[model samples]
Target: MEDRRALATLPPLRGRVQQDAPLAPFTWFRVGGPAEWLVRPADVDDLLLLLRDLPESVPLSIIGAASNLIIRDGGVRGVVVRLGGKAFGEVSVDGDGIIAGAAALDAVVAEHAAATGLAGLEFLCGIPGAIGGAVAMNAGAYGSEVKDVLDWAEVATPAGVIRMAAQDFAFAYRKAVLPARGVVTRARFHARPGDAAAISTRMAEIRAAREATQPVRARTGGSTFKNPPGAKAWALVDAAGCRGLVRGGAQVSEKHTNFLLNLGGATAADIEGLGEEMRARVLATSGVSLEWEIKRIGEVTP
Candidate 1:
């Protein structure tokens, strides 16, 4: 209701637009409230046109796989656009390089690369988020980050689409510096020729490591906080004795202190509050202050 005029104008949209759509179902944590307006564009052109034609007053936000995300209980205001289906889900091979749509899952891209004998991207198999969010935050695992292999990414901004190079991302630790509200649509990565069998074996090992170290079965956001400089975040959290700490229905994953889980019937506020408490506890135990890696959006209920 905050942007009523803008919402009313969406009926003519080429894509599906729903009012008060349930957002919790889209997320890994299975929490949060509704999306005031959820936009599902038909394709890249539809999305670009929608972004161009829409009023500037109506705030727009983008989401992908919903992994590593927490939408607050009050719900998101303005418009929430998610790229999905065949339109944004394609990953194509180009010689030793590959182009992945933003909506494409990291696992799928990894598999594609493996099948195509593309090495240097096996690490992406461990990341749970889609390529869009992965490029946005430079998501990675297994000693290889996105910045290391990403040649360029195509992003849609308020002004227009731009092909952003690796240097333009200004990536560091676990963050990327891009224009405000610029959404990634596609990414290009360069890989070397390798044996498909070897690539598959590496991906299998990554899967095993993830299963052993992370709470893959829990309703949780992956990696609650970024590891501070030289220290592992989980180590600090463990030292603080905050492992298995609980708040409301949410609890720190005992399997990995870096992950926070919603143990059924948990509120978004509960998860966020638990994260803050863990942060404080870790700070109290160690001098290092852990920065949140998970993206929290939307508002709290009034």
Candidate 2:
């Protein structure tokens, strides 16, 4: 009853809203339950309006491409916002700078930068998910991270949209401290003049490396664990004999032990449980506890 009243009081916006929307299709693993409420605002203004007016009591969650995420079986409660479409997926170049909407794919942004002869963002080509998620997590690859190129980002909070400098994010390995309930709208990245062909070649090399070593075509979340200090997560997992380890329908990718795959018909529980098993094995063997890089959310089946 309270949920109905909250829904009725939601501010009208030029966006799509749904109740009990299936969220599996939104993720790379293609496993998960529904969202209690899913909102996709048409533009930044619409987003701001929603943020400003949403009841403080209502739970709000945000998702990007869900490349490195696991949403559990019992579904997420309250509202879940996913930014997309031209309003949040545009990528453009301004001189040596690239401006990308939060929803723009990291690879797309890298391509746009390459087309504009900007070189610094080539690393983005290897990172999965959207700019928003990249910025939030300091996503990196090929010895480069978002912090290396990000100049500033615009985030919409309940108060208003605020432009924050990259340093203000206090970026650390695979993490950033964003404002409470703030949604990244877009970001500006600093780049430099470079040979487009060379940049493209480098991106291609990274792509080839990923395809050869990782499960690029599998139903997998990106890297499952953070590389512990002075140690690669994959190497540790392999050393612990966790390569291709299976639990139910989920398995550690034989190609890359750091990744977890849903081998068709896998539930979220199966995938997560497999990851836990891998962690236990690594800890018992190497005495190095692994931290998850993939974000997990929602409730488990009761």
Candidate 3:
């Protein structure tokens, strides 16, 4: 009775269920094993029904457009809930506010806002994750962040649907301390009126900046480590001579040491090992410990 085959015993779901689904294709790192059980709920109602009846002992995990994650080589256990479909991809303009489904891509949200002459969300165009993941982590870039624009978010929790504000989450510097077991479903962000042309121009600049600084085309786990306090993570990594450092099929990006890249055929172990080595090197040289920004999930291959 392996976990992959255990999904059949769970309470009935109103969504598609796949056992032993390969997870590598869903991640930016593109290097992981399978999910023991992957569930994509058709809509919020469907998701809520499933969550309400789900066994308390069964683990629940959610992934968005799926960046900033490392699904280990031995695959995940329990249910990996991915919010998708029309129910989770809609973007609407509510006055000066933009309401987006959690599954909507950050880039798409940016585009929707810009198209509606909203200015504050231009930074989202540069983020690779979807709104669900973005909301979960208070994802940000350049000088702007989600907390600045987020009015409230709809999440499914054990107590049923709840509206959580930025203050509720205590959002700070790429961190959002959400309620345990809550799943973000939708978000409403407040934006100011601006010239559509100006917003588009700003988005273009941000995208261009990312292209110049990051190894955008490579299979990478976005930023491997968060900036340690006042020190830039990349500078410390470079000072430690870790730029372009290689481990198995993974390498620290020459273009951006902050990012760990799969140079092709790298396993989850190789990538994680390289990141740990970076942390050690940086700590030894800078006396400052780097913290992982990427969420590493699942089991390691023995």
Candidate 4:
């Protein structure tokens, strides 16, 4: 049983809080058990204060849109912080720069930038995650990545709120080397100007390309694993004879081998088990290890 003593003393929050909330409602996969305490912060200040005041023993996990996440079936203990409403979904454009709140969707950012004739963020149109997630994972598509245009990002740390320059967060393929204690709140990106018609055309082309190749419409996380140097993970998986492979109700996507699809009634364990099986098979056949791109959180049911 969760103790409500700590929460009772804190002043009322601008956001909503629910005890024993079902997490599946917030995730794209529509799977997962309940969160012990689910809190949606109204803004950056709300989030920081909540984090600062919460007891050290109470665990906290920050989630953006749950686009690349899998919360296990046994459920997450302690608190789950999700940024909500306009406080964390603002997007603004100034001159050659774009400012986005952490909870803003990547597709919305892309559209906003493209409307202003910004060229670089067109790649974001193909990504289906929040700005914070894009920052955390260095999400990318086509030939561009978030790191390429990122000027700076604002993050809340255990110490305090800090503005971190792009260099401060060392970035690599689909990963950021921020201090493990940091959590992003917002980001600023700079892009070159382009013809409005051309930008729109490019975004449409990218969207079409993704639809043609990926299971974009399905209830699934984007990619399962990153491609190793000079090799594609999907090809390795396909070569391992795992294409259209099934484990319980989860299956390797027929459209894209790197994608794993939940064919209704699938559990997180089933999905993760299939992913592990694919990795093991691929390693055995290709002599190379695959790294999971999808972030897994919470405990597995025993």
Candidate 5:
């Protein structure tokens, strides 16, 4: 097969590489098919080598945390790179700045910053996913966004790694114009000295609020759709009577209409189908089309 030949042509790597690696376990929903190739680079050098020499015919996809994502059942083609290990998960602080590897979970970064008496990043405790995905999507919660504090981010492209300033990202609500095929490796966020007690209190409040309102324990992907301008996505879903709606084994979370859950035996199709139905219902009732906040990838089953 072409995939096998493409694998053969890859330059030697220090990282782990696999053909037909199961991707379901890597995601929160616990569904979807295997990836054509799953690669975990040992370090930045190893990642650079793979990126610089990968065949042009093959496609490359980057995933992080797999928290707010849905990989379709037909699986992903070409290469899927998942950054991990201490090299990509380290979080440290220097003076008024915090440096976090792209693989670092947003909550871990928030904790690290708070431990060092740094404020302004406590909002990260409320956002799911890793720093890389957060930066790529301009993720935000509790009235703050990544763009509000990010100083700069380093991204790796086939050409080479480049350090881009926050302004260079041209961040918009829940989106950024990151370079095509560029993978975020790390980011620096601006912080300021604040009362440690105050920061900790803020984070705790966020955690409590999330637990009360969201389906934190279910097999679910966080927030199914983006909030339309001047309107809330969850309210629209509830208004359309989509709360607890079901398709196959997937159901809309009764606790939070914005979340879609896989009740043990759901397929990727079932979850995605339920989301489409929710959108249709909302559009029909509210005349506002919902945009997906969760990233969905790979081919649908034929």
Candidate 6:
């Protein structure tokens, strides 16, 4: 284990640092345990100083809104950084381009751009994540992905901060091949102009589609599995008769088979166990191996 004492004595550091911070409040599922040390950096300077001074042995995990994550019940070790305040949530429009801080909500940025009659970012209206997460996951909806509109991003590297162009980010279907240790601080997007009414209509349609097909009302980490090539994960799960299946408090969503819902009080192990079962059955029945879309971190209870 790393030294918790050092973190405690590191002055104010301009941001609040809490010991054993409950993670359930931060995550969408509302089921995770605590983070050993949760640090909300007030600004980039605060973050850089903390990172520079912290011992290399002490690990750090960066999270945005926690929409596509599963923090296990045993809690995460080391420091968990969640950027906050005006510095990390700023969004500004410069002509046809938009600059957003890491903590800016995707929906907020999309609405702002849309209000300005920008069209390219309408797809982001349906994504429930922060700008950093949207950039990291290459998050998409309907037909457009973040890669289509992203101009560049600013990242905090071990050596220092650096700006990376869109081409510099190795973007795959739903993955960004940035260094695991790199922390994204801000991003820029290039959106084109379109009729604001049309964009709003399209956003509404997307929201309705999600409501009809996903368990959006339930505690969940969006889709549990990614669609494999040539087949949709949800269709495969439904075909395998996994829909509405329950294991403890975790249930394979009746609305969307690929989504696992925390009906009320589900533990991380229960959800993971149900996921394993779904995978096994899907493989046995359809000969297709489903890959998880949601990132799982931390540990499970013994």
TM-score of each: 0.97, 0.98, 0.96, 0.96, 0.98, 0.95
lDDT of 4 by residue, 118-214 (tens): 8789999889999998998899989999989899999987667889888877889999977645678889999989999999999889989998999
lDDT for each residue of candidate 1 in 1-302, tens digit (9 for 90 to 100): 54787667653778888989999999999999899889998887778777777787887889899999999999998889999858888899988888999999999999999988999999999999999999889897999999999999998876789999999999988889878678889999999999989999999999999999999998999999998888899999999998899999999999999999999989999999999999888888787788999999999887
Native-structure RMSD, model 1: 1.3
What is the per-residue lDDT of model 3 for residues 129-246, given as tens digits with 9 covering 90 to 100? Answer: 9998998999999898899999999999866889987789899888898776889999999999999888889999999999999999999989888987778999999999998999
CA deviation > 4 Å runs, candidate 2: none
Q: Which pairs clash in the backbone of model 1?
A: none
* Candidate 1: segments with Cα more than 4 A from true spot: none
> How far off is model 2, as Cα RMSD?
0.9
- Itemize residue pairs with steric clashes in candidate 4: none
Q: Clashes in model 6: which pairs?
A: none
lDDT of 2 by residue, 163-260 (tens): 99999999999999899999999999999999989999999999999889889999999999999999999999999999888888999998999999
> Local distance difference test, per candidate?
0.90, 0.93, 0.89, 0.87, 0.94, 0.86
Candidate 6 global lDDT: 0.86
Report the lDDT of model 5 for residue 175.
94
**Can you rank all candidates by lDDT, best first?**
5, 2, 1, 3, 4, 6
lDDT of 3 at 130: 94
- 112 Cα displacement, candidate 4 (Å): 0.7
Best by lDDT: 5
Candidate 6: worst 10 consecutive residues by lDDT? 1-10
